[model samples]
Target: MPSLTAVCRVHALLDDSGSVGVTAIDKRPVDGPVEVKRLGVRGDVQASRAHHGGPDKAVYAYADSDAEHFAGILGYEVTPGLFGENLRVDGLDVTGAVIGERWAVGETLVLQVTMPRTPCATFARRLGESGWVKRFQAEGRPGAYLSIVKAGPIRAGDPIEVVSRPAHGVTIGDVFAGLEPEQASKLLASPAPRLSEIVHGLAEKALTRAAVGA
Candidate 1:
Protein backbone atom coordinates (compact mmCIF):
# COMPACT_ATOMS: atom_id res chain seq x y z
CA MET A 1 0.00 0.00 0.00
CA PRO A 2 0.97 3.65 -0.16
CA SER A 3 3.26 4.63 2.72
CA LEU A 4 1.99 8.10 3.69
CA THR A 5 0.63 11.36 2.40
CA ALA A 6 -0.50 14.78 3.69
CA VAL A 7 -4.07 15.37 4.79
CA CYS A 8 -5.46 17.72 2.18
CA ARG A 9 -8.53 19.06 4.02
CA VAL A 10 -11.45 18.28 6.31
CA HIS A 11 -15.21 18.77 6.01
CA ALA A 12 -18.45 18.35 8.01
CA LEU A 13 -22.09 18.08 7.10
CA LEU A 14 -25.42 17.78 8.85
CA ASP A 15 -27.35 14.49 8.84
CA ASP A 16 -30.34 15.43 6.71
CA SER A 17 -32.37 12.53 8.08
CA GLY A 18 -33.27 14.78 11.06
CA SER A 19 -31.69 12.09 13.23
CA VAL A 20 -28.32 12.10 11.43
CA GLY A 21 -29.15 9.02 9.42
CA VAL A 22 -26.80 7.21 7.06
CA THR A 23 -26.49 7.64 3.26
CA ALA A 24 -23.88 9.17 1.03
CA ILE A 25 -24.84 12.70 0.09
CA ASP A 26 -21.55 14.34 -0.82
CA LYS A 27 -18.29 12.65 -1.76
CA ARG A 28 -15.59 12.66 -4.45
CA PRO A 29 -14.40 9.45 -6.04
CA VAL A 30 -13.55 9.92 -9.69
CA ASP A 31 -10.28 11.59 -10.72
CA GLY A 32 -9.89 13.47 -7.39
CA PRO A 33 -9.70 13.25 -3.61
CA VAL A 34 -12.65 12.19 -1.45
CA GLU A 35 -14.22 14.22 1.35
CA VAL A 36 -14.23 12.85 4.92
CA LYS A 37 -16.13 14.63 7.71
CA ARG A 38 -15.39 14.86 11.44
CA LEU A 39 -17.99 13.06 13.57
CA GLY A 40 -17.92 14.28 17.19
CA VAL A 41 -16.39 17.67 17.87
CA ARG A 42 -19.72 19.44 17.91
CA GLY A 43 -22.47 20.00 20.47
CA ASP A 44 -24.99 18.13 18.36
CA VAL A 45 -23.07 14.84 18.24
CA GLN A 46 -23.14 12.75 21.42
CA ALA A 47 -22.65 9.14 22.45
CA SER A 48 -26.07 8.86 24.07
CA ARG A 49 -28.76 6.66 22.50
CA ALA A 50 -31.32 9.37 23.05
CA HIS A 51 -31.62 11.85 20.22
CA HIS A 52 -30.63 14.63 22.60
CA GLY A 53 -27.24 16.20 21.83
CA GLY A 54 -23.58 15.65 22.66
CA PRO A 55 -20.05 15.95 21.32
CA ASP A 56 -19.18 13.86 18.28
CA LYS A 57 -16.28 11.68 19.43
CA ALA A 58 -17.08 8.73 17.19
CA VAL A 59 -17.84 9.15 13.50
CA TYR A 60 -19.28 6.45 11.25
CA ALA A 61 -18.58 6.42 7.56
CA TYR A 62 -18.94 4.04 4.65
CA ALA A 63 -16.19 1.57 3.82
CA ASP A 64 -13.40 2.70 1.55
CA SER A 65 -11.06 -0.26 1.88
CA ASP A 66 -9.65 0.00 -1.60
CA ALA A 67 -10.48 1.69 -4.85
CA GLU A 68 -11.92 -1.56 -6.09
CA HIS A 69 -13.62 -2.28 -2.80
CA PHE A 70 -15.34 1.07 -2.81
CA ALA A 71 -16.34 0.76 -6.39
CA GLY A 72 -17.52 -2.81 -6.19
CA ILE A 73 -19.02 -2.94 -2.71
CA LEU A 74 -19.97 0.54 -1.48
CA GLY A 75 -20.38 1.98 -5.02
CA TYR A 76 -18.57 5.18 -3.94
CA GLU A 77 -15.80 6.67 -1.84
CA VAL A 78 -17.87 7.73 1.19
CA THR A 79 -20.87 5.62 2.00
CA PRO A 80 -22.78 6.27 5.22
CA GLY A 81 -22.07 3.70 7.94
CA LEU A 82 -20.92 3.87 11.58
CA PHE A 83 -17.48 4.89 12.73
CA GLY A 84 -16.27 6.31 16.09
CA GLU A 85 -13.05 7.68 14.74
CA ASN A 86 -11.45 11.07 15.23
CA LEU A 87 -9.70 10.77 11.92
CA ARG A 88 -10.84 8.78 8.87
CA VAL A 89 -7.54 7.37 7.73
CA ASP A 90 -7.58 6.74 4.01
CA GLY A 91 -5.33 3.64 3.94
CA LEU A 92 -4.66 2.46 7.44
CA ASP A 93 -5.49 -1.07 8.62
CA VAL A 94 -7.70 0.41 11.32
CA THR A 95 -9.42 -2.80 12.41
CA GLY A 96 -6.14 -4.65 12.84
CA ALA A 97 -4.91 -2.25 15.52
CA VAL A 98 -4.47 -3.32 19.15
CA ILE A 99 -5.16 -1.41 22.35
CA GLY A 100 -2.39 0.81 23.79
CA GLU A 101 -0.99 1.10 20.29
CA ARG A 102 -0.13 4.64 19.20
CA TRP A 103 -0.34 6.19 15.76
CA ALA A 104 0.34 9.71 14.54
CA VAL A 105 -1.85 11.37 11.97
CA GLY A 106 -0.17 13.94 9.81
CA GLU A 107 2.49 15.33 12.16
CA THR A 108 0.95 16.70 15.33
CA LEU A 109 -2.08 14.47 15.80
CA VAL A 110 -1.30 11.47 18.02
CA LEU A 111 -3.87 8.93 19.22
CA GLN A 112 -3.87 5.80 21.38
CA VAL A 113 -6.25 2.91 21.01
CA THR A 114 -8.61 3.22 23.96
CA MET A 115 -11.34 0.76 23.03
CA PRO A 116 -13.28 -0.88 20.28
CA ARG A 117 -16.48 0.98 19.50
CA THR A 118 -19.64 -0.53 20.87
CA PRO A 119 -22.71 0.26 18.87
CA CYS A 120 -25.07 2.69 20.56
CA ALA A 121 -28.74 3.51 20.10
CA THR A 122 -28.22 6.38 17.74
CA PHE A 123 -26.34 4.02 15.47
CA ALA A 124 -29.39 1.80 15.01
CA ARG A 125 -31.48 4.86 14.25
CA ARG A 126 -28.88 6.03 11.79
CA LEU A 127 -28.96 2.70 10.05
CA GLY A 128 -32.74 2.93 9.88
CA GLU A 129 -33.07 -0.46 11.53
CA SER A 130 -32.50 -2.51 14.65
CA GLY A 131 -30.26 -5.48 15.58
CA TRP A 132 -27.32 -3.80 13.88
CA VAL A 133 -25.55 -3.63 17.20
CA LYS A 134 -25.86 -7.38 17.55
CA ARG A 135 -24.35 -7.81 14.11
CA PHE A 136 -21.23 -5.94 15.18
CA GLN A 137 -20.94 -7.75 18.47
CA ALA A 138 -21.38 -11.10 16.77
CA GLU A 139 -18.78 -10.46 14.08
CA GLY A 140 -16.22 -8.70 16.33
CA ARG A 141 -15.75 -5.83 13.87
CA PRO A 142 -16.66 -3.09 16.29
CA GLY A 143 -14.11 -0.66 14.86
CA ALA A 144 -11.72 1.45 16.94
CA TYR A 145 -12.34 4.00 19.66
CA LEU A 146 -9.31 6.16 20.28
CA SER A 147 -8.15 8.44 23.06
CA ILE A 148 -6.48 11.62 22.03
CA VAL A 149 -3.12 11.79 23.76
CA LYS A 150 -1.95 14.86 21.86
CA ALA A 151 -4.67 17.01 20.43
CA GLY A 152 -4.03 18.20 16.91
CA PRO A 153 -5.87 19.18 13.79
CA ILE A 154 -6.77 16.32 11.42
CA ARG A 155 -7.88 16.38 7.85
CA ALA A 156 -8.62 14.10 4.90
CA GLY A 157 -5.78 12.41 3.01
CA ASP A 158 -3.46 12.92 5.96
CA PRO A 159 -0.78 10.29 6.36
CA ILE A 160 -0.93 8.03 9.43
CA GLU A 161 1.99 6.07 10.96
CA VAL A 162 2.33 3.71 13.91
CA VAL A 163 4.62 5.12 16.60
CA SER A 164 4.13 2.47 19.27
CA ARG A 165 2.75 -1.03 19.74
CA PRO A 166 0.70 -2.46 22.58
CA ALA A 167 2.82 -3.65 25.50
CA HIS A 168 0.37 -6.35 26.57
CA GLY A 169 0.06 -7.73 23.05
CA VAL A 170 -3.67 -7.23 23.50
CA THR A 171 -5.25 -5.28 20.68
CA ILE A 172 -8.33 -3.09 20.85
CA GLY A 173 -10.10 -5.73 18.78
CA ASP A 174 -9.30 -8.39 21.36
CA VAL A 175 -10.82 -6.41 24.21
CA PHE A 176 -13.99 -5.88 22.28
CA ALA A 177 -14.11 -9.55 21.39
CA GLY A 178 -13.81 -10.55 25.06
CA LEU A 179 -15.91 -7.82 26.73
CA GLU A 180 -18.96 -8.87 28.75
CA PRO A 181 -20.89 -6.02 30.30
CA GLU A 182 -22.30 -7.86 33.36
CA GLN A 183 -18.89 -9.26 34.21
CA ALA A 184 -17.24 -5.89 33.72
CA SER A 185 -18.25 -4.73 37.20
CA LYS A 186 -15.79 -6.85 39.14
CA LEU A 187 -12.90 -5.49 37.16
CA LEU A 188 -13.69 -2.08 38.57
CA ALA A 189 -13.71 -3.41 42.15
CA SER A 190 -10.15 -4.56 41.73
CA PRO A 191 -7.21 -2.27 42.48
CA ALA A 192 -6.21 -1.65 38.89
CA PRO A 193 -6.86 2.07 38.86
CA ARG A 194 -4.48 2.50 35.97
CA LEU A 195 -7.01 1.01 33.55
CA SER A 196 -9.35 3.28 31.67
CA GLU A 197 -12.82 3.67 33.10
CA ILE A 198 -14.49 1.85 30.20
CA VAL A 199 -12.03 -1.03 30.28
CA HIS A 200 -12.37 -1.39 34.01
CA GLY A 201 -16.13 -1.35 33.71
CA LEU A 202 -16.12 -4.20 31.21
CA ALA A 203 -13.72 -6.28 33.26
CA GLU A 204 -15.60 -5.71 36.49
CA LYS A 205 -18.79 -6.86 34.91
CA ALA A 206 -17.15 -10.04 33.69
CA LEU A 207 -15.63 -10.65 37.12
CA THR A 208 -19.02 -10.37 38.77
CA ARG A 209 -20.30 -13.16 36.57
CA ALA A 210 -17.32 -15.34 37.40
CA ALA A 211 -17.88 -14.81 41.15
CA VAL A 212 -21.51 -15.80 40.85
CA GLY A 213 -20.49 -18.92 38.98
CA ALA A 214 -17.86 -19.74 41.58
Candidate 2:
Protein backbone atom coordinates (compact mmCIF):
# COMPACT_ATOMS: atom_id res chain seq x y z
CA MET A 1 0.00 0.00 0.00
CA PRO A 2 1.09 3.53 -0.67
CA SER A 3 2.21 5.47 2.40
CA LEU A 4 1.43 9.03 3.42
CA THR A 5 4.32 11.48 3.08
CA ALA A 6 4.79 14.95 4.45
CA VAL A 7 4.69 17.54 1.69
CA CYS A 8 5.15 20.62 3.82
CA ARG A 9 5.47 21.40 7.50
CA VAL A 10 4.71 24.99 8.41
CA HIS A 11 5.17 26.90 11.64
CA ALA A 12 3.55 30.27 12.12
CA LEU A 13 4.49 32.93 14.63
CA LEU A 14 2.52 35.85 15.96
CA ASP A 15 4.07 39.17 16.83
CA ASP A 16 2.36 40.21 20.07
CA SER A 17 -0.96 38.66 18.89
CA GLY A 18 -1.40 40.11 15.39
CA SER A 19 1.47 39.61 13.00
CA VAL A 20 1.39 36.04 11.75
CA GLY A 21 4.21 34.85 9.51
CA VAL A 22 5.46 31.41 8.55
CA THR A 23 9.13 30.73 9.20
CA ALA A 24 11.66 27.94 9.63
CA ILE A 25 12.25 27.25 13.29
CA ASP A 26 15.54 25.44 12.90
CA LYS A 27 17.36 25.53 9.57
CA ARG A 28 17.56 28.64 7.38
CA PRO A 29 15.75 29.18 4.10
CA VAL A 30 17.89 27.98 1.23
CA ASP A 31 17.81 28.28 -2.56
CA GLY A 32 14.40 27.17 -3.87
CA PRO A 33 13.99 24.87 -0.85
CA VAL A 34 12.91 26.06 2.57
CA GLU A 35 15.23 24.55 5.14
CA VAL A 36 13.27 22.16 7.36
CA LYS A 37 14.25 22.53 10.98
CA ARG A 38 14.65 19.99 13.73
CA LEU A 39 12.00 20.95 16.25
CA GLY A 40 12.42 19.41 19.70
CA VAL A 41 9.57 17.73 21.57
CA ARG A 42 8.55 20.81 23.53
CA GLY A 43 10.57 23.73 22.26
CA ASP A 44 8.75 27.00 22.26
CA VAL A 45 8.08 29.15 19.20
CA GLN A 46 7.93 32.69 20.51
CA ALA A 47 5.14 33.82 18.23
CA SER A 48 3.13 30.66 18.45
CA ARG A 49 3.62 30.27 22.18
CA ALA A 50 2.81 33.92 22.71
CA HIS A 51 -0.30 33.40 20.60
CA HIS A 52 -1.11 30.22 22.60
CA GLY A 53 -0.18 27.77 19.90
CA GLY A 54 1.67 24.85 21.44
CA PRO A 55 5.45 24.97 21.18
CA ASP A 56 5.53 21.57 19.47
CA LYS A 57 2.62 22.34 17.21
CA ALA A 58 3.33 22.32 13.47
CA VAL A 59 1.21 22.27 10.33
CA TYR A 60 1.76 19.30 8.05
CA ALA A 61 0.77 18.91 4.42
CA TYR A 62 -0.28 15.56 3.02
CA ALA A 63 -0.68 14.46 -0.60
CA ASP A 64 -3.98 12.62 -0.18
CA SER A 65 -6.36 11.75 2.69
CA ASP A 66 -9.63 13.29 1.75
CA ALA A 67 -12.51 10.96 0.98
CA GLU A 68 -14.66 13.63 -0.57
CA HIS A 69 -14.57 13.16 -4.31
CA PHE A 70 -16.16 16.08 -6.05
CA ALA A 71 -14.87 19.27 -4.46
CA GLY A 72 -11.75 19.59 -2.39
CA ILE A 73 -12.21 21.41 0.88
CA LEU A 74 -10.99 24.96 0.30
CA GLY A 75 -8.68 27.06 2.45
CA TYR A 76 -10.64 29.17 4.93
CA GLU A 77 -12.87 26.19 4.26
CA VAL A 78 -13.36 25.05 7.84
CA THR A 79 -13.13 27.04 11.07
CA PRO A 80 -9.32 27.15 11.05
CA GLY A 81 -8.74 26.46 7.34
CA LEU A 82 -5.83 24.54 5.82
CA PHE A 83 -3.27 26.29 7.97
CA GLY A 84 -4.99 25.65 11.29
CA GLU A 85 -3.72 22.12 11.81
CA ASN A 86 -0.74 21.67 14.13
CA LEU A 87 0.35 18.85 11.89
CA ARG A 88 -1.15 18.83 8.43
CA VAL A 89 -1.13 15.32 7.05
CA ASP A 90 -1.97 14.94 3.36
CA GLY A 91 -2.65 11.21 3.14
CA LEU A 92 -4.55 10.67 6.37
CA ASP A 93 -8.29 10.32 6.11
CA VAL A 94 -8.55 11.00 9.82
CA THR A 95 -11.80 12.93 9.67
CA GLY A 96 -14.01 10.01 10.72
CA ALA A 97 -11.47 7.76 12.35
CA VAL A 98 -12.12 5.98 15.66
CA ILE A 99 -10.20 5.78 18.92
CA GLY A 100 -7.29 3.34 19.33
CA GLU A 101 -6.20 3.56 15.72
CA ARG A 102 -2.41 3.57 15.61
CA TRP A 103 -0.39 5.48 13.05
CA ALA A 104 3.35 5.29 12.61
CA VAL A 105 5.30 8.22 11.23
CA GLY A 106 8.79 7.57 9.81
CA GLU A 107 9.38 4.75 12.32
CA THR A 108 10.26 7.32 14.92
CA LEU A 109 6.85 8.38 16.14
CA VAL A 110 3.70 6.46 16.89
CA LEU A 111 0.55 8.42 17.49
CA GLN A 112 -2.86 7.16 18.45
CA VAL A 113 -5.65 9.24 16.98
CA THR A 114 -7.44 9.65 20.29
CA MET A 115 -10.12 12.30 19.83
CA PRO A 116 -11.44 15.00 17.51
CA ARG A 117 -10.13 18.51 17.97
CA THR A 118 -12.91 20.83 19.03
CA PRO A 119 -12.99 24.50 18.22
CA CYS A 120 -11.91 26.64 21.11
CA ALA A 121 -12.76 30.31 21.58
CA THR A 122 -9.12 31.25 21.05
CA PHE A 123 -9.16 29.69 17.61
CA ALA A 124 -12.24 31.63 16.56
CA ARG A 125 -11.04 34.92 18.00
CA ARG A 126 -7.48 34.53 16.77
CA LEU A 127 -8.57 33.89 13.22
CA GLY A 128 -11.14 36.70 13.50
CA GLU A 129 -13.01 35.14 10.63
CA SER A 130 -16.74 34.85 10.82
CA GLY A 131 -18.49 31.50 10.78
CA TRP A 132 -15.26 29.69 11.53
CA VAL A 133 -16.55 27.30 14.17
CA LYS A 134 -19.86 26.84 12.40
CA ARG A 135 -18.16 25.85 9.18
CA PHE A 136 -16.24 23.00 10.82
CA GLN A 137 -19.25 21.77 12.80
CA ALA A 138 -21.35 21.74 9.64
CA GLU A 139 -18.93 19.47 7.80
CA GLY A 140 -17.94 17.26 10.80
CA ARG A 141 -14.36 17.14 9.54
CA PRO A 142 -12.69 17.94 12.86
CA GLY A 143 -9.05 16.89 12.81
CA ALA A 144 -7.87 14.11 15.11
CA TYR A 145 -6.04 14.61 18.41
CA LEU A 146 -2.69 12.92 18.63
CA SER A 147 -1.21 11.36 21.77
CA ILE A 148 2.40 10.76 20.94
CA VAL A 149 3.49 7.22 21.72
CA LYS A 150 7.07 7.83 20.68
CA ALA A 151 8.56 11.32 20.70
CA GLY A 152 10.98 12.34 17.96
CA PRO A 153 11.76 15.12 15.55
CA ILE A 154 9.70 15.30 12.35
CA ARG A 155 10.45 17.23 9.19
CA ALA A 156 9.08 17.53 5.70
CA GLY A 157 9.05 14.39 3.55
CA ASP A 158 8.32 12.08 6.49
CA PRO A 159 6.00 9.16 5.75
CA ILE A 160 2.93 8.07 7.76
CA GLU A 161 1.56 4.57 7.91
CA VAL A 162 -1.30 2.88 9.73
CA VAL A 163 0.21 0.11 11.80
CA SER A 164 -2.93 -0.97 13.65
CA ARG A 165 -6.66 -0.47 13.56
CA PRO A 166 -9.08 0.05 16.40
CA ALA A 167 -10.70 -3.23 17.37
CA HIS A 168 -13.94 -1.68 18.65
CA GLY A 169 -14.98 -0.46 15.22
CA VAL A 170 -15.81 2.94 16.67
CA THR A 171 -13.87 5.73 14.99
CA ILE A 172 -12.23 8.78 16.47
CA GLY A 173 -15.06 10.73 14.88
CA ASP A 174 -17.57 8.68 16.84
CA VAL A 175 -15.77 9.49 20.06
CA PHE A 176 -16.27 13.21 19.51
CA ALA A 177 -19.62 13.16 17.79
CA GLY A 178 -22.14 14.33 20.36
CA LEU A 179 -19.99 12.64 22.94
CA GLU A 180 -21.74 12.92 26.27
CA PRO A 181 -20.01 12.08 29.52
CA GLU A 182 -21.42 8.58 29.49
CA GLN A 183 -20.34 7.82 25.96
CA ALA A 184 -16.86 9.12 26.52
CA SER A 185 -16.53 6.90 29.55
CA LYS A 186 -17.68 3.82 27.71
CA LEU A 187 -15.09 4.39 25.01
CA LEU A 188 -12.32 4.83 27.52
CA ALA A 189 -13.36 1.81 29.51
CA SER A 190 -13.41 -0.40 26.48
CA PRO A 191 -10.89 -3.20 26.12
CA ALA A 192 -8.52 -1.12 24.07
CA PRO A 193 -6.71 1.12 26.54
CA ARG A 194 -6.92 4.86 26.16
CA LEU A 195 -3.82 6.65 24.92
CA SER A 196 -3.78 9.29 27.65
CA GLU A 197 -4.20 8.53 31.31
CA ILE A 198 -5.78 11.89 31.95
CA VAL A 199 -8.46 11.19 29.39
CA HIS A 200 -8.96 7.74 30.81
CA GLY A 201 -9.57 9.11 34.29
CA LEU A 202 -12.10 11.60 33.01
CA ALA A 203 -13.91 8.82 31.23
CA GLU A 204 -13.94 6.71 34.35
CA LYS A 205 -15.59 9.44 36.38
CA ALA A 206 -18.18 9.98 33.73
CA LEU A 207 -18.91 6.28 33.69
CA THR A 208 -19.33 6.30 37.45
CA ARG A 209 -21.86 9.07 37.20
CA ALA A 210 -23.72 7.27 34.48
CA ALA A 211 -23.88 4.16 36.63
CA VAL A 212 -25.32 6.19 39.51
CA GLY A 213 -28.00 7.57 37.22
CA ALA A 214 -28.83 4.06 36.02
Off by over 4 Å in 2: 1-12, 15-82, 180-186, 195-214
Question: Model 1, 50: alpha-carbon shift in Å?
Answer: 9.3
**Cα shift from native, residue 164, model 1 (Å):** 1.1
RMSD of 2: 6.1
TM-score of each: 0.60, 0.61
The whole-model lDDT of each prediction reads: 0.47, 0.49
Model 1 residue 88 lDDT score: 42
lDDT per residue (tens digit) for residues 108-204 in model 2: 7666666666665445555466776776566666666566666665544557788887655556555545556656655765777454553465566
Please report how far candidate 2 places residue 176 from its true position, in Å: 2.3
